[model samples]
Target chain A: MKQRLVSPVRMVWLLGALLIVCILASFTLGHYPVPLGQLLGILGSRLGLPIEVSWTPQMETAVWNIRLPRVLMSVLVGACLAGAGASYQGIFQNPMASPDILGASAGAGFGAALSILIGLSSVGIMVAAFAASLATVALVFTVSRHAKGDRVLGLVLSGIMVSSLFQSATSFIKLVADPNNKLPQITYWLMGSLSGAKWSEIGFILPPMLAGLIPLLLMRWQLNVVTMGDDEARAMGVNAPRIRLWTVLCSTLVTAAAVSVSGMIGWVGLVIPHMTRRLLGADYRCLMPGSMLGGGIFLLVVDNVSRNATTAGIPIGILTAFIGAPFFLWLITGKGDHYEH
Target chain B: MSIEVSHLSFSYGQRQVLHDISFQVRQGEFLSILGPNGVGKSTLFRCVLGLLSGYTGQVLIHGTDARSFSVREAAKHIAYIPQSSRPIFNYSVSNIVLMGRSGSLSTFQTPSKADEERCAWALEKVGIPHLARRCYHRLSGGEQQLVLIARALVQDAPILMLDEPTANLDFGNQLLVLEQAKSLTRDGYTVIQTTHHPEQSYLFSDRILALQNGRILTQGAPSQVLTEQTMAQLYGAAVTVVSLYQDKVRVCVPKHITIQEEAK
Candidate 1:
């Protein structure tokens, strides 16, 4: 029971260093490879700093225009999803709870697909996806409010129903979409990619992501009380219902924002928090930041593999499942007893 | 009085669960509520904790109406130890104990040094400082219950309400937990506990209240309230009360059934 892992402080440093390395490696090794020095030089030039190195326009474009934004997006989206997932799991007091448990991903997927079908602009698609995700969560909340017996179970059950409803809607959109024109685009989007990640998109995602993340980070200690169950939390002087509502709201917002940008990147949200918990015990004060850093590093590595491992870049969503599924299997089977207690 | 409930009644939809229940607990007094299943002992605890609303009468904590108390305000006066259940996540024992300080801490603030000291003190008081760093869910049922009691102690509440504190424990652990609870009254903590064992009530409680069908069948000192007739009527089984230890200690034993014994 007292088997020691790395201390939490050192764990944070390790993950942070790994994230930095992944970011730098992702910048240096892409389809159009830029050397590390030139990559740094190009970054410095863009930041209006004096650096003595000759860098070509193509290297600058690849480093600044394409790879940097994609890498940053992956980090933010990964962190956002992981943070949301951890919060959801704590609030529900269920280890299996994830960011997509309440239909946010499904709703965003349907919105993105519908926008593609209707030929909306990229901004419009993102906005539509965001709005749809929020709407779907609101619907789930309304439905679960009317449900009797075990409020958390009610929310989860309602989430399943609403997710299926949105999933069918997405399927219908795909079916009716123009096969040659919109179909491939919709399919690729559903599979999820960071290929289209742009610097402008960061502006759109950063605010909501921070808005959702900051509150959860601040309330991490209170979340421990929440996991003790509602009646117990209440008796301990924590307003379980109010804290739960805020948690749900923040998690849904962050999750929807991430999905809208990254197109249904799965597994990172569900797996990263569990991985962090194994290393750090289930104290949310450590778990929240640990999961955030772990998730960022995880996706950075996955995104790096997706882009560099193949001539034609693999979609990140596919790679996440490929890596995450096996890892999850090992987690549940290998260390299952640790989690069960 | 540390806690008082007067004519408190509660219902779920059309069916009533607690009917005209009244009780008063003084400072440092140990009151054990004895009841069979479905007799609303838990419901009464909830009412006193202000977790239930729309009840018929009043619950007064330190002479103030309980209905007006916020969750934090209630926590200041009363700490509750629920029956132990396994948590989903494996939190460290220290973190689990630290959660008791949540009522006093602000929403965004972490536990201060003083608060941590109090948590450590509570753990030491419960005699489980060795288990402080162990994962809470990894502990035994008795150990988990002890941690919960330590959590209640950290809350620094005057009145402690425990619902079946020894329900799932082994015989030794049951005695250990009950002994700990009984000792708290000596430290100026008013304890209200619901228990199934009449002998435990007889041994540990200064006052005993026997509840059946949401009503108090009898309420007084343990020797007067816990009689063979009331025990039989409460559980619908014939029983005999016997005294031992120079007629100071009382115990209840079931009367043997002639038919069942012959079949056996």
Candidate 2:
């Protein structure tokens, strides 16, 4: 067992294979079950693989246009949340920090809520949600920019303030919303399902996700320095303040995009980074990518459970909350108590 | 190697902390700063290190303005050992010392084999090579302080800045670390350290600087700066300074009344 303790490197490769298996399983076994070979044939047909390409047009549409995009969206959003979470944790020097506390996810939720309450179109609603999340993070960044020392503390306080302001604004919109039509739409969106995903939404999400994740991958080493304290970081020749500002901007944007599309997928961000930290140690070079992969696989499993729950379509967020709440309590009370007050 | 500070004055907003603090140390000299509490010793060092800017007058290192240097560039020439015990984690002793090398390395490079060797050499020099593998927090307060010094040693800069390097040490570690710092000056490394122990400063330092009220009261050889009149003026107490062994060493005993109270 001791010898089997996989380094983050080996574990990442292992998780990659497991994710592939789960992805294949989830795609094959959804409602109106496509056979594994037929699903493979359809996927192979799309990629120009030489085969008879067995499924009908409607089956092909369901598998390729619907299931595939939804799964891909889950993977993308999951990886983004976990990566953003780890980045936030490193920036704040607090293990409990995640994008939710930093106003990215809640900001998006409030934005979408406002749009639904105001009777906007689908694309307009998505844009509203994305913009609101971005705006909230920007507000937090601006307010906390001048705080002397403890930039993370400045961020959390400002984020909570912004979240509350937007949340109240959303409540006001809901109070005035058309209860007959708008309210149900708002609540349904808030429940958060990949059923709403499409190729265009995926298009909007991928750029910000890639834009943020790539830089985080490259600069993971620098994040390690800043976590040790900015003065200590500057003493070591790193321009800690500049690095922090850039990272906060990138991470905020990615988390905002994820939340805009996925409706505040809880626990992936909080749990993934903590799990990565425990499994991988504190080295960001390993932890950053490890969190990303682990988050993708974890979300895939949860999404699979949501699809297969007994005659009830479970909200993936609720599943995460169920798993996350206990794990969070354990984190606070268990071995990770060093992070808490 | 030569450090020259000309008429340096600093303040936090309206309240001045260091005023007209002028002093110089020739290349490869070991100097100790001694003063009563709240005498701006740390403030003076911070000015020289350029951590606190907007101070009047110029601090010139090798005839260049200290203010002109970036934090990294300044750190490249000077290694600062701030007072320790601020860390909450159990970073290893060797790892802590190896952090001294960070300023010199590029952004992407991890600590190299040579850096590890320097860390080893520094730990060995401080006579705690065995403790190199131990967790920093698990060590005694004295050992922890020495580990901090070992970090400074590995920095390999020409000038070492220490803030009360022995404040928490046991008597033996105090003498040990000070002797090690004194020996550094022999190899052409300049040392500027603050100390409450005037006797040890007199024993190990080439010069002593006395500061009070955000200004330098006196700075010269130990004989000139550690005089009875200067001690009385700086500390604002009636102090008796005694010399022995052909005036090679001076000791500052409490003003007899304080000593009496200690006996009681």
Candidate 3:
């Protein structure tokens, strides 16, 4: 039989299949190792399939209340991070730029850390976290507006400096918290897990994610122009300065929200966009959605391993660092294809 | 649209570059700025393009002060192709040209079918249509300059400005760029350019504006401004100017013109 390579249509089907596998696999990878049948039964029950099951509270609590929300949160946060990263790298015209490195992430991390230092509880923490994230994004924007026109280098450099400052202060603040009571909690949160994600956290993130992604999708072609450089972009009739302003504002907002809740999910925001570029090419029309799916699924898998990779219950970031390091090294030293034309 | 600069005096940090330089570009004339290096050709062009702020003068493009125009609005009226620039990254040739469309577009809008057609036409007009899909940075220097000119052409602005547009290009590419500039001027688009080659000013320009040490030395026809005396004063060297076929001026510099020899 002659071999037929898959078309883009088939490839899209493959992406959908992979998404299903990831979701199912995520539900089964936790500590208790919920059986495939029981996992499906719980999911089906929630979806109104009326499957009968043992009413053991452990099954209901672990599957419905705990693992389900955590997994969903992982997908949502990962998608947001990856999308934000793609937009950011596009605007900066640099392949290595990520949401965290440019100060947006650090700023959000600092705001949340400061809120924790002020002794807010779980209910208050969510409010403080989202508010602080938005506030940090606003600070980056306000500082970057040096002239009447949009200033790209100005925004990026300031972002870097501000982030470093916040990071040092966060370390100092973390040091002074009560070691026995609050220190361990702060440490765990910094590991960046989906364990804290709730319905309300989802609610807060959804609005900005949708708001941010809509403009990006609409202006996808302009992002193509921006990649050419600002002067060239202006000649194309893009109001290059204002486009820069709007894009930075939206990307910063999404990144701030992602960093606020998860602490700092590293690599997904940077590497996923590059991966999408390699996979789908630099055309932002497809690359934007590709990064969204790729980022979420990558994190979903990492989170699965974090919950049950070892008996020690490893912190998510440690596991992510371990998984991401070898690939990053391979990306740097291997075929030299990351910025392919 | 006419470009009018009147009583324009500009300086850079106490070092004056242009003093009371006044000129008017008729609605579709090809105007050339002719001067040796260190003259105010580029400074004058930048001031007219509104790239610099706080210069005392009046630069009116299409009957409005340059300061009154937004960057995009100015781009719509006056398109610029710099002498050369290094983007240092990979972007498609078509994408590079598409930037000329942004000044007329909104943030939420995209390059339309009409815009893409214009990009194609501009690239084809400059004779580099095949490079549209290739990486911009990998093109040769001549090809890069052509690509930038194509971008400006696509802007479809009424007034086009080029600064040293032929400085680094090879002989053939220089002809190519200059001829394209000439065609734009012929099409009723006011073309303003700066050149070090005095002969080039006569060959390609309808009006020559010569500068020496931050002031207009002379502004008129080639025969009126370019002389053996003017070349000697600008370079401090002995030279000769000759009129060639088709009213083109030919410039020749002696290999061994010394002050001692001249004094003797």
Go through the candidates in order and give each one's DockQ. Answer: 0.59, 0.30, 0.31
| lDDT per residue as tens, model 3, A1-341 | 11224432344456557767898887667666677888888778889997998546688778777777778778877888888888888788777778765576676666666777788876565556667666665666677776334467777777777777778987987999888867777677667766656777777777877787778768776787777677656544455566667877777667766766677778888777777665655666567777788888888888877777677667666766777777777776865433323
Q: Candidate 3: where is the Cα deviation over 4 Å?
A: A1-21, A28-64, A137-154, A311-313, A334-341, B12-15, B36-38, B235-237, B246-249, B255-264
Q: If the candidates were sorted by their DockQ against the true structure, best first, what order would they fall in?
A: 1, 3, 2
* Top candidate by TM-score: 1
CA lDDT, candidate 2, residue A15: 75
Residue B136 CA displacement from its true place in model 2, Å? 4.5
Runs in model 2 with CA error above 4 Å? A1-25, A28-45, A51-63, A145-152, A336-341, B85-101, B105-156, B171-176, B237-251, B257-264
**Whole-model lDDT, model 3:** 0.75
C-alpha RMSD values across all candidates: 2.5, 4.0, 4.5
A108-213 per-residue lDDT for model 1 (tens digits): 9999999999999999889998989999999999999999998999999999999999999999988999999899988888898888799889999889999999
Better of 1 and 2 by lDDT: 1
How much is A186 displaced in model 3, in angstroms?
Answer: 1.5
Candidates in order have lDDT scores of 0.89, 0.79, 0.75
What lDDT score is found at residue B97 in candidate 1? 88
Native A-B contact fraction in model 3 = 0.41
The residue ranges of model 1 lying beyond 4 angstroms of the native Cα positions read: A337-341, B257-264
